[model samples]
Target: MKKLTTGLASASLAALALGAITPGVAAASPAPSPSPTADAGRSAGPAAPIVSRIEKHGADRIALLGVAPWAEQVRMQFDGGGSVEPVTDGRYTFLIDKTHLGKTATLTSFAGGIEGESIDVALTLDEDAAPGIIPVMPRVLGVSKDSQGVFVIEGTVTYDPLQFDQLEVTASTGGMPIRSVPDVNGTFTLTIPAEFAGRQIGVQAHLGNKSSAVDTIDLLETRPNTASDTHPLAILSPWAGAELAEPAVTFSGVAIPNSQIVVTNDAETDQRFATLCETNVLANGKWTCDSPRLPDGEYSATVTEKPTWSSVTEQTEGSSFSIVHGDWKPAAPALPHLSSITDSGDHLIVRVVIPGASRASLEVGEHRDEQQGINGRFSFWVEKSLAGQTATVAGLVDQSVGKALDIPLTPIADTITPAPLTAPVIHHVADEGGHVYLEGTTGYAPFEFFTPGVIAKKDGKLIGSTELTYNGAFILRLDEEYVGDEIELFSTRNLELSTATELVVAETEKNSAPETFPLEVTSPADGATVPATSPTFTGEGIPGAKVRVEDTTAADKAPVLVCGADVLADGTWSCEAEKPLAHGEHTTTVTEAPFWVSAGTPTTTRGFTIGDADSDDEAPIVVTTPADGSTFLAGSDVTFTGTATPGADIALHLGYGLAPVIGTADAEGDWSVSRWLGNAPYTATVIQSKNGKQLSGAHTGPTITPAS
Candidate 1:
């Protein structure tokens, strides 16, 4: 293809926040540390996911602008809905679809291979609910100059996308921006003035703050058919001129596969090529034909190809050949091998070694080649443009006998020096209208070296990009509309982006948390048994969290399938086993999935038998304080106590719909939680588990009744 594999560095805004590859460093260079530090055993783990954008209804496109730092995986669980895990490249943004208004999404990140904190995000319907547009990058397919001298460029964007509304064209040689409207299929065509011929031009699609990678094309007055894979028409055998031994002349050559060749005798006598000589085109494009006996001395023929496809038909002049009946033909020379191809920036040095030939010639594209004596070696200098094309080396051992070999060419980049490193900083400010600013110190010096670029993003949206360290300092300005906006500031030296620092804005400033839907440990009574197959677990969690079942009987406490359940409207939930369980005593735990930050992270565990319960494994739960059927006086500090399986977590529930007071059972199966009950007499229920973070179970000590 005529198009080269190149990247649009400045314009690929969507591609900047991706992957872990460090920029500017070669395989032998020192490894640079990540901006927020490496992804090793970090105790702080991944940062909580921020709500980047939330579209109300249309697509319900939910997004978080920046990826969670150090997150290997991220999961989202909507209260009463299933979870969507790892939906992004952990870069620019994380995305999911749903009309999640008034509902919360629990975002949990795992970093350094450890489960981190889960943050709840709920977006309100407002102008800020929608975020910046999705980025569309256009790729140039082909470029050519029309007969009218105008350059025609064609390209495509990823989706028949609305995101690609405008095509922006810029020329490096100076010119105003050229714009074009792209069709619905994400395809666009535009023309550049003839003056741009021989100059490099860059084209990309734009949508607000986002743009695709630029496709730079070097314009040629008349585009050669360089995109075609069909090799240019040529004669590869009996090469050009070969004296024949017998008068029954025969000719062979190569051309576009399956073509019809016509050879005309150029002699003044009748122009027939001795018999209607029409050769069959081989799959490999080789063809041969035999001519009737001829009393020939020296002669030339015009060879023409009539293509079966749309390719142009052209005539080629065959080098003159003579017919010598006494067998004066020489043996064909062997193929040639390349000794070295060196790059001198503007041109290349090609050295070849051919055996069994005293003289040879080399041709690279349209370069003029000269015949040179070959003591098994010959050298040629060719244009730098031929770096990715092919070169041919031919040897002539005798009259009418020769062979040619093709070798590919490649370019080399030898002198590469990187720019010095610069550290960047971002300052956090509360929401208020004013001239906001950030300034920092840098140790970077400018000695004519290419400096690292700095891009500032607010809520995962590009805000500004600036050239840093001209003389070791840089400045950027922002209006008040971005006050209280979260932005990440970092320096990008090579290909990799290290998240430098962030200006955090608390969502609570604009959004209030949804009412804390009650969480209850209310099902699968502790020590209850059921069939080994289709085991069922049930519970109730604060709105916006799913329930999960875990096999707590095991040493490591493995998950029971992906066993999960959406919460029922009435503050209850039920989940079924994904697979069959073993017919033995087991301790199962159920807990709200994607642990939340606030209160109500309720969990419960139950020991039950699939076939027969092991009496020793079953631990009965007991509530010893605020005695059963008893009530504490209103406005009194009450201490409740319970006992269950050793090391089990405890949740003491007061009937006033408040968050559970949590405690843990010790080795002796003892647990207690003290709470100040205010203004109302209340009953209490105790729910115990094999572990605290387990699932919901039926409340024990069902009543401790007393009137206010």
Candidate 2:
């Protein structure tokens, strides 16, 4: 026998007899088999051919048959005829190799007279393979119903198989089919039929090989219709039938939720409306409408609803009311009537009357207000420009308005005038110098004066008539004239006219004897030296005569010494020198009895050095001591000594750093100062002053050091 090929092993073994069979021909049976059973069994007729059977167990083994009932040795042949030891007791076995599971195989047996029997069979192995199972039905999510009693089904489905072909859905109600579909996600729409509007239904989902659990859904009828009468609508404010302006009239009211509103005039024409325009009502219930201003006439407005009560209804018969135009009347007593308007530079006043009215209003341009006065007699201040210009005033009564009346006026001016004149009188007298004095007076608000004419011939033969002052009175000084020379005095109010007033004039020489001298000075003789103390003067003339000694250089100059009257009783004149004079010559003049004239031409001319020593030079010496550009600390002692022309008065002036400082020097040419210096540069100057006048020379100094 040949070894079985790998391909045929499985098929060949599996086709063999079951485990109960034995393999190979029966062992050669003993020839004496007949004697064994005695002659009765008669010799085993030609030893029964050794018979063998083969069988397979599980999938890996094949059994072979043995010859005797319990024969042990047995052999088998596979499809390729290869022999293999097999199990005894009629069992033969071979593994159905996985490699040959799908191939065909044959097994044959050979024994005695039993011809070879061949068994051909296809091989099969139990398989553990499992196929994926997936659901084919879509998930039923939810359902929706429309007013028409139609139902809409919505959901999604999943199919994982590559060859999946179709899906189907079916929905039923009370076991009655309602809808069906062939695609997974496809929708199914159906009407429940009017009879089933409020009924319940069951829904089911199906795929090719699977069906989903059933779910229940309910369908409901559409909302019921709302009744008009149950929802009352009222015109809360501008009540129905109210009439208003055509361009603008407001109407307001309240209504039920979702209710319809309509408005119209008597003619049934719709009026424009707005719900927000109405006030005092909830948003869901309020409404307002504006009507065009009606003509000046009567009309009616109506608010209504159609189809009073039906589900689909019409507007109602509106509540109707009458509207009439408003009575717009002008208030009484029209602006007061002005007859005329006049003004002074300051104010304008108007004349007006309100006939039968007690109070009236007056208006200038746009101004108006009630004015008070009985029978409307009122006045108003008019502006200056309104003067001489026309203004209008209207008169009104009850419902009757009147037109305005125009008025005009003029202003006045002011003036002034002059007064009259009067005539004057004259008087005359003569003095010891043969001079004549004439005086006169004029009678007028402010009197005038005139020069009296002298009558050389007593008849006014004066060559020229002198014109005197035009003021109240006059005085004339006439020079010497012949004694007893018939003089006349004449007065005239106007020089151009020949009018005159004359009085006999007699020239009498008064105080004929020459006046005696009243005073003379005896002390401080001419050219005498005087000290800085009070200087005295003795005078001899008339006892108790008034006298005065004046520094001639200081005379007629401002700031001169003024003497009191008592200084003259002792025939002595005295005065204190306010300032020291330099060592030099100075002249002092004396006057007596009267102050206008000098007694004898400065009776005392003197030269005296106010210092202890004297020098002859009259020219002032320039001092350079306390030298220029010198500086000292504050509170430092400073001395200045300089020699100048003999009679020069040297005054040292201390100035604050470029500013003027006040100080003084005595008659001697020496100066010393003990002053604290300020905190700035300073200048020191030497000044020569005499007779209230000064001459200065300057030198600057460095800034003073402030004391620590």
Candidate maximizing TM-score: 1
- The whole-model lDDT of each prediction reads 0.47, 0.35
Q: Highest lDDT among the candidates is held by which one?
A: 1
lDDT of 2 at 609: 33
How high is the lDDT of residue 293 in model 1?
57
lDDT by residue for model 2 over 119-230, one digit each (tens)? 3344443233122223333334444455665655543333211112233455566656765542211323344554555566656655446565665556543433332332
Off by over 4 Å in 2: 1-147, 150-196, 199-223, 227-230, 240-247, 268-283, 304-311, 326-708
Worst 10 residues of 1 by lDDT: 1-10
TM-score of each: 0.22, 0.16
Can you write out model 1's per-residue Cα lDDT over 486-535, one digit (the tens) per residue? Answer: 77765654333444566653222211111333445444456655544555
lDDT for model 2 comes to 0.35
